[model samples]
Target: EPEVTQTPSHQVTQMGQEVILRCVPISNHLYFYWYRQILGQKVEFLVSFYNNEISEKSEIFDDQFSVERPDGSNFTLKIRSTKLEDSAMYFCASTNTRDRDTFGSGTRLTVV
Candidate 1:
């Protein structure tokens, strides 16, 4: 079965630094999304992308955060500046239909 893949399974960064997490979703899937789970917290939706544009975003996806599909197969999440609170497990997910989603093993971002 096709699944989402995330690189650098874990990352550690200094505060105020920039970090980009990468993902490649199932080829046939259309909807893409980024969600994050703070340690001990529930997963929260960050942003959703479709047709190469942002379809929806939550308050957490502020100016400092951005998502892009530089190439048809790669989806990326960039945090312009890291903060202590930014440490979390970020998940990449994609789905062909609205009913189900396949999530990548998260990229754990740790801001020091």
Candidate 2:
């Protein structure tokens, strides 16, 4: 099965540095989402974008985070000002609908 894949599986960043996590979502899917898990915390939705515009976004997607679909297969999340609290597992997911979705292996962000 074709699944989403994220690069660097893990990343360590310094506070206030910029980080861009890459993802290749499933082809033929229309919806893309960014979700995060802060250590053992519950999965939190950050944002959802489709058709070249943001569809939905949670409060967690603040001024520091932005997402872009630079190509047909690539989706990227950029954090402009990483904070110590930003350390978490960032997962990229895609869905044709709520019933069908795939999640990437995830990039573990570590702020030091």
Candidate 3:
């Protein structure tokens, strides 16, 4: 079986600092997305990427955030400046169709 992988399982950053979360999707999947979950909240969709461009994004993906598939294999999310509210478990996911998505373990971002 294939799965998504994320690095630095945990991260801590000072308020206003920058952070980059990395993920590698399953080789055969096409749709890729970034989602997050606040400690006590439900998972929220942040952005979706396909064909090397952003296919969709939610209100949470504001100007301060950006995502890139710098190389064909790795997808990255860069938060230009961190805030207390940005602290959450960020998950990376991918799927070949709309039926289901495989999610990464998650990169827990903590803003202090």
- Return the top candidate by TM-score: 1
Q: Candidate 3: which pairs clash?
A: none
Candidates arranged by TM-score, highest first: 1, 3, 2
> How accurate locally is residue 82 in candidate 3, as Cα lDDT from 0 to 100?
94
lDDT of each: 0.96, 0.93, 0.95
The TM-score measured for candidate 2 stands at: 0.96
Clashing pairs in 2: none
Better-scoring candidate (TM-score), 1 or 3:
1
lDDT of 1 by residue, 18-103 (tens): 99999999999999999999999999999999999999999999999999999899999999989999999999999999768999
Stretches > 4 Å off in candidate 1: none
Candidate 2 residue 33 C-alpha distance from true site, Å: 0.3
Residue lDDT tens for model 3, 1-112: 8889998799999999999999999998999999999999999999999999999999999999999999899999999889999999999999998669999999999999
Q: Please say which candidate is ahead in lDDT: 1 or 2.
A: 1
For every model shown, the clashing-pair count is: 0, 0, 0
Q: In angstroms, how far off is 78's CA in candidate 3?
A: 0.4
